[model samples]
Target: MDGSLKEEQILMSSERDWTDLPPNLIHLISQKLPDLRYFIRCGAVCKRWFSSILLSDPPPQQLPWLIEYDEQFPRASPLKEELPFYSFVTGETGSIPIQESHRGKVYHRTGHSYLLVIDGEVISLFNPLTNEEISLPQLPSRFDFIWPVFGGADPSRNWPWHISLVCDVGRSRYLTYYLDRMRWQCFDTVLHKTCNWDGMLFTTEDHGTSTLVFDAASRKELYTIPPLNEETFGFITSYFVESCGELLRVSLDYNLTRNIETYIFLIYKLNFEGGKGQPHWVKVSNIRDQIIFLDHLTGFAVRATAGLKGNCIYFFIEEHCRSDRFYNDSTLWRYDIATGTCEPVPCPFNRCSWFVPNLR
Candidate 1:
């Protein structure tokens, strides 16, 4: 009789309506969600739950979503109609719809949550998470290839957002756009890689032998930091990322010969107040409580939460092997900064970009 009574109570509780829960309790539960996807799903349970989630604070740290371009899609289909985002935490894929005006456009690059898309001569910034689109003025002439670098936003400046468009012809040229001004300015210098830090734009040339700093507000070159004379035998790629109120540069050296490939990673932090009041690179072995996400083009850093790992780099490697013919293989890898070790992580897409989703 006691067992039967307990069973009946359990059945009644299982059938209870979850929507009747107190809003404060629901908000607390929403705050405990592991990631953004779960938080979004929790809001979909009911209208009351959605209201509670809106009042709750999201997770402080978030892992970036991998946005991939589907090669299997029909060539005539609009590429920007929908984007597939893969989550590392859940190991699941989800689709986010693009705005109707952004359809049929091609994206040149991605920075954080924003996509730099081009339609004919017009360029626009689209945020898939928020469904916000801002169109820029048309370019003077359309280029065959465009490599765009986002300088983020500075509310203190006259123009808040800064974008640099590098036209790849025989020689590289830069075209900068100011958001508030709604105009473009052409620069004659050639830049290899660019990143934004503390309201300034940093550019590298000649394989990062030197770094040029440009004031995003004034549109003038501030100063240049001398190169670090490091010798290695393979192709070197450098990435600049800001983390923990400081700027860092991560360099990857790799050699592909025959069927074997070797990779080495080195990290350096920029010290603004060094000896004699000049900025210089300081070699760093560990970056505590921070995670870095990198691709071939750009990279960014984020704080690590309980669900994420810190002092490591999450990047992908595209391998080409020539056995009978030529074939390509892509794999995601995690490199530990302290141990100098690398391990492979499973990824569904061969080519993807790291997108940090934001509700704002």
Candidate 2:
């Protein structure tokens, strides 16, 4: 062939019709792509390419796969930085910025799309997707409101559209609030006697406890956990991780022996659908090395960091001394249950009381 003709053939080959490729070959290109944008670019090459990529089996496993440690890995000087938030998919850090700090502050994360925030007496439901927030009725602070815990039906399930909060005051009083209903109801449970301000409202897929919602107008604990016999208490703390479709509760007992204090970590699976509570809890970790639960991390023990894929629980381990609270330098570590390993991830902030993963 002529030299000019040969050069033209090479150019045509570079622009070969993407439709000529098989579906599997197109899928390989999508998976092998390093980032989401690149995968998207591949789909834009041609109509057939886009259709094949989208229709390919196993769909694109685009849910955040890798944990992106912000400039803040091996987070040291805990108090110096606020909790770090990031997007696992974009490898972005501190994605959500709090322009105006509210009075009640954010309690628990509902999903990657929404967060439950308390402002004064009212509850603010913030949606990251719409970038808009709605205000709910003021909660009875005296009753001691429960944190909002959320989960979906499954990976194929719809995004969570509602939330529940269970409030308890003193003893023999309980209340439950459902966000969808925008109302409060009263129920009685065996736990009425065992319930305390520190006693948390538990939920899971099977036999889980419902959130106690408080009525500011009634000024009473109205909701109660049924079949309370299934409910057990020792040291209870709950948190939801968006990266993994699961809610985690760390229960432990701390007792002092011979002037030494010890801590144990027990994990519980939350049953959100069946409203059934699990009788047995799973033990995750235990540190007997003269460690005391710092008063700061008493209620909310575990937090999920943003920008990571998979089930990794970020715990703020406080080093306490008999003289006073362990403030100076705190260590943040990631406990990866899948790998059964705990390693320190770096953070860029200081004096971080809690970690809010960036939801971008």
Candidate 3:
């Protein structure tokens, strides 16, 4: 306290009235603030700061908003649990309540105003921000769930949206939906996992060991990453994420049998240099000061704060326990990319999804 006061006295000694600074200078100060908490605090400091916060965007790269849920959706929220949004920059978690009218499983995030959901034949897009909704034609009777394959350089009218869903379980049959033509391309292919930023779709073979990507539009084989080196644990899984324009592969290792209390993480970046060359996995020592947010199925990466450290991964750690007495230790965790270590994070949420608050 004394040190802070001393510093303030030293600044005041200059005999300069900071509040008299022009609005442009004040705006520049707000633009330089990377953390949201400090940004909000600056707004309360004075009129100029408050105006700057409201007039400008928080930052170009905002942290992913994590939304928490229970074991399964459509379950009764006896407690009326509220969804929490955690920010990596501020190291704070803020909750936004789910309305009583809002029900059914949150299938997938479509946009800032829409979330795509499917219930049997009915497929709808609900906007929780404004409580508005728009329902499209019912999905084909064959597909059980809808998974969207997004990202690419050309996301305009050229490529609307590429989605895949399971049609037949026994035959391992699936179909891809192209929005431009309003047609479903049905085929039996590898487990259509995820896609990258360049409109290439990726899949795994040999029991989730190898990765192969192909052009979704041309239907031509692009290339494949090397086979994954298995981890010691039996419950290891891999996921592909489009991060800050680069493609990243993350391997998560955990103990399914028991809560052994440790997590292993390996992060690799695909090196693409020299225009058209063979792409290979490179062990990333740093993520260029970014953090990857991972759920079970899909994940995204964002610019991490300097205080939080870079090359680290944030995971929604689900703690599975015995006795089945309705207990779960679903805590947020941070895994260091450089040291290969894991630790508990301060933010807490049960069913959280990566979200960005509706600024609109």
Q: How much RMSD separates candidate 3 from the native structure?
A: 6.4
Candidate that scores best on lDDT = 1
Off by over 4 Å in 1: 10-16, 55-61, 72-80, 151-159, 170-182, 206-208, 217-221, 258-262, 274-276, 318-328
Q: Give the per-residue lDDT digits (tens) of candidate 2, residues 14-78.
A: 89564799988888776665445456568788898889867864323233222222333222111
lDDT of 3 at 17: 71
**What C-alpha RMSD separates each model from the true structure?**
4.0, 10.9, 6.4
Worst 10 residues of 1 by lDDT: 319-328
lDDT score at residue 109, model 1, on the 0-100 scale: 50
Q: Of models 2 and 3, which has the larger lDDT?
A: 3
Task: Please list the C-alpha lDDT of all candidates, in the order they appear.
Answer: 0.69, 0.40, 0.57
lDDT of 1 by residue, 1-360 (tens): 699999999998889788999989987887677678888999999999989888876655467888885564311113566888888878899988877866777776565667777777667767777777777777777766565555432211224455666665444555443333566755545665677567677777535478888776676988788886777545667888767767888887655552222456788898877435667788898899888888655677777764777999998774432222322344577888877776767778876777777665
Badly placed stretches (over 4 Å) of model 2 are: 1-84, 87-94, 97-112, 117-122, 138-146, 151-162, 166-180, 185-249, 252-264, 268-312, 318-331, 336-341, 351-360
Please tell me which predicted candidate would have the highest TM-score against the true structure.
Answer: 1
Clashing pairs for predicted structure model 3, backbone only: 65-355, 67-352, 67-353, 68-351, 68-352, 69-351
CA lDDT, candidate 2, residue 59:
28
lDDT of 3 by residue, 1-360 (tens): 699999989888978776677777777776676654556677787787677668876544445556555555422122133554666556677765556755544455332223555545666555454455555555555444455444421122232444443332445544544332554444346464555445566666323376777776666778887776655555656767666778887777765554423567766777766547877777666776777777554566766653667778887665432213322453677888777777766666556555544332
